[model samples]
Target chain A: MKRRLLLVSNSTLHGGGYLQHCQQQIQDFFGKNVKRILFVPYALHDRDAYTKTARDKFKTLGYEVDSVHETPDPVDAVRKAEGIFIGGGNTFRLLKALYDSKLVTEIRKRVLEDGIPYMGSSAGTNVSTISINTTNDMPIVYPPTFAAIGLVPFNINPHFLDADPNSKHMGETREQRIVQYHEELDTPCVLGLREGSMLLVEGNKATLLGSTKARLFQRGKQTTEHDPGSDLSFLLTEAQ
Target chain B: MKRRLLLVSNSTLHGGGYLQHCQQQIQDFFGKNVKRILFVPYALHDRDAYTKTARDKFKTLGYEVDSVHETPDPVDAVRKAEGIFIGGGNTFRLLKALYDSKLVTEIRKRVLEDGIPYMGSSAGTNVSTISINTTNDMPIVYPPTFAAIGLVPFNINPHFLDADPNSKHMGETREQRIVQYHEELDTPCVLGLREGSMLLVEGNKATLLGSTKARLFQRGKQTTEHDPGSDLSFLLTEAQ
Candidate 1:
């Protein structure tokens, strides 16, 4: 079975309700077959509050949400989940929690082999890539390793922002940091998903979703912008 | 013997030459007694280029610069050095190289035990703290541990900037990220060292040196601002 994934750049936009804009996309991706979603709220600091927020959001979309934290066995929950949803928060904490629960391999197997639909936003989207090396979050905690689920070929830098032309700040811009990453690690392109943007994957077909353009970065090459409807499926086969 | 440290937030200002703004402080930190200094260029991508830059800058300040990478025995060079300097680059790379060369312990002993004057900028300054947890650089590579030299009691977030009130970016501000860090690990305080700022340490006395104010963050406490020339020696004793 081919895999399906919805990688969102952020859960809430400025002055927007939680996952409000992406509700239609969420409904379209899962269809009517996925009646229940096993939510992973590990990225959040307050897991109970995060789970409740997600539960309320999914309920409005006509689906029952069961958070993995409330489950007796998270691994078993993933094994039987019709779909999985990982919310956004600190990427380090989320990755550490995933490792601590030993859900890395199980999630990969469920999504890649079993064809269970998977969805993640922000830090959630960050961990769906090959590694969490490109995250913008502070290293509040160190994980055993930088490796992630590797469901996608390239790394995702969610909540990507363009440099302010009039700013006086001397810190590196997001583009410069991504360029530095390429300078150190030659392979693996970085996809900069701006706010209100997302990537949709179905089998081998990957498409850019939402209104904003996504920026793509590779070593020794100029960054290119892709429009919302453009096909990014080629990225799947580029990984070596 | 008392340990002496000069932790600079950046190597250069917006329109200035490398180390141009901090030359006087560099000279004042290492008096006429120090004839030669050892440079650690491992943080940069091009060691030779970075070393030459440091050598040129130090020469103008009347001190001979010898890079550890050029020495046949780096450990021996660190042991006999009068002063040590670490240039700015990616913090993760610098810490990893320090571990790879087994220079962490040697450098620590030389600076903290023997009282050899130590200086570092940007990534260099980030590693001088207890951990590289508050750095703004991308995690291009994973180090064996986030554990650094622990020369200072608190972590330093170098090149820190305040939020732009007019900006529409949805990403977390520098202050917010540091606050999140405290929420996870509450004990250690985070000092937001703006560009052009440096911390001068002599044993237990630490003074904020520069023309701008530095922001300090601690868990459950309001963020405090300290002006230039203010005494921050109290932070040195707050480690427990």
Candidate 2:
């Protein structure tokens, strides 16, 4: 239960550069304790390019960062890193890479047992939850399963967009998709993290943070919207 | 391969009733040969209600339909069916149900070996392709794998939408998602079935049908838009 995580709904907000929207939050969360960050860039196609972008951003935020893909042993990279940040891309691809590289358990151990701070955005945030079942991403590639890092107790749906009352699209709305998820699984809770929204978890306490509102959904219960400073401790205590 | 499929992009179009937009294509695909349709209502939660809706719609078009859930042995129902139709809801839920009930092989035999007409919409159309890797639905549940009926040589992306240039959403557009699929997979081809569009496949022949245009994407190639009445027999011959 000693989890310390900074889960972001999106990497870059609209009309902004990469990680520009939440620079101060990210820096404050990591603080001076984390000198270097181990970056996972497997979510995108070009691992080197993705790594360079993340490395540069973290460097700008006053931290030295290296990508796991650059290391000969990824699990070893996780074992020795001071901090970790998995960037946003396709969830399935990211999870598959995690499983393939055997970094899932190592990262879990480092964050929970070793007490290193973990950061994630979009697809990264989706995988840090109990499962990737609520992701807005297409099943472009299927991993071995939908199982992901169980860092937190509840599921996270990042980049969550509300249904537009003016549009007439035939596809299911984001709310309807989460409703269907609740109907299908015994999963206890799912948090809809809108763009520019984020969550900070420290041990037993969970706090909603960012510029937008977050949504809380439970099985067979009405969903409620939460403001930036709302306490989401109920989700951590609920059944998974 | 005697695969006969009427793959629809969506069940309903903007401002249209259930299955109202593509009623004629469905009627022509099944023809007078299929006296009764054995509907797979597993994609939806309320199978009975879903069946009733489909039954009523097909009844108006001069065909009798019964749901697989209403029957005791769903496998037997597929074995003895004149035609089969799987409605849209959640792709993960539908594929998991299909795998759980052991109907994937049965339905494949009926559609391929027996030459019974088959119809699918949205999620249904996704599972009918080589894999459910290109589906637009959220993965609400975990199936055994991404493997599907493989009734066709390529994958189908149902309810496909182009990226709105003016919109400032950071989420991957439908095109970007498909592009990512090509990047991660050796998947030979994927067809983006826009809303109100359909595809008809019969014995080594596949043709674009319905009102809207379809977009085609191949690995490491430029995407091309195809209009209604365009020949897509190339898909049937591509490497899967």
Candidate 3:
């Protein structure tokens, strides 16, 4: 099978219905025969919540899910799996833990070289990008870490939204933030994705899924909004 | 005279005018005696436009204007100034040059130790913080280059406004960003300033300026709003 990729969102789970959207996407990728390998990189603080939840979810799906923590080798568990899913939490913390354990490199190898069916939601999706420019965290404490799996050429700004009434900051809004990003970087497209939206990459083509809009930002100009209807087959078929 | 400090903004005499809001804050800091010291750190690429325009502005204020590239001893120039200003432009380029030249350290010393009045606009304000998390630029190709002057303990997210009508990405709004920042960081406050807003810090005390509300975010929670009022002597006196 081709290397399949699914990006789930971490914006909200309001009503305990958050995981349903993600389940639909997982089914789309794995189908009935899907065997899931879930990674909870962000729940280092609360293993029971993030990790156990994944185990329960995968078990319900009739697929086995295991948590990888201390290993002489990081890839031993993921390499044998057909589908890999990264759940969301504190992206910075999740990325920090992954880097500390040195699991990111292996995951990258599995996704990029081995072409495993890779899926990430929230923090998981964040790790797939070139960097986390769109993260809503402060720069005071450096996480002693860096960007995502480099699965795609662009940077991912997860949980992107417009301004709110309660805020006092001005300048380029989230859209403007992407515009500024384009103005600065030469390569690396910025993908501004909302919740329930997934960028599925299969065999050199990437496709946008779900209800929200997937906006693209290039260097030297403003952002242009794209939808699943907008020849998104280019995303699925684009070269690695 | 106090060491010369100039506040450089990303705005020009005629343009998008975003920097003007910051300029007004700097003026309030120095009052009518505001001595303009123009220092163009990145405009070296376009010598004609950046330098000529900076020089003209400085001459208009009856003070000396010099580029960081032109000054053989930037340290000396910083020492003799009443105030120093770094304007905004391509923030990445400006920061890269300052970081490469080691001017950021020298500028920091002049402000913190020598007690010279220091100011910045847009990119200028960005570099004053311990980190540039509020900067609306890409984090991937740029890396996490948050080597700013560190004049202030916290980060400044200026030009605060609500979201535009025509945009798509749905993440945390700007207010939510502040909340998330506070959740992650411990002490460094996230000051969300609107176009006319500013924060005056002298010693351990600080005050907020502008007619609009200034929101404070701490320890990963939603922002708490505060109206600074028209007068700011309370903060100035407290800082002293």
Report the poorest 10 consecutive residues by lDDT, candidate 2 chain A: A231-240
| Model 1 chain A worst lDDT run, 10 consecutive residues | A178-187
How accurately is candidate 2 docked according to DockQ? Answer: 0.83
In CAPRI terms, model 3 is classed as acceptable
Q: After superposing candidate 2, which stretches have Cα over 4 Å from the reference?
A: A238-240
TM-score of each prediction:
0.96, 0.98, 0.75
Tens-digit lDDT track of model 3 for A1-240: 355788766634434454665676677676777665756545235665667677777676677776665234556776666667777655666677677767778887877788777878776787787666555433333456566676776666667665566543434456655654554435466677766677887866777877678777666546678775345554332341
* Model 1 fnat value: 0.61
Model 3: reference contacts kept, as a fraction: 0.31
For model 3 chain A, where is the 10-residue window of minimal lDDT? A231-240
Question: What's each prediction's clash count?
Answer: 0, 0, 43
- Per-candidate local distance difference test: 0.90, 0.90, 0.60
Q: Looking at every candidate separately, what fraction of the true A–B Cα contacts under 8 Å does it contain? A: 0.61, 0.85, 0.31
**Taking the tens digit of each residue's C-alpha lDDT, what string does model 2 give over A143-164?**
8878898898789999999888
Which structure is stronger by TM-score: 1 or 3? 1
Looking at model 2, residue B40 earns an lDDT score of: 91
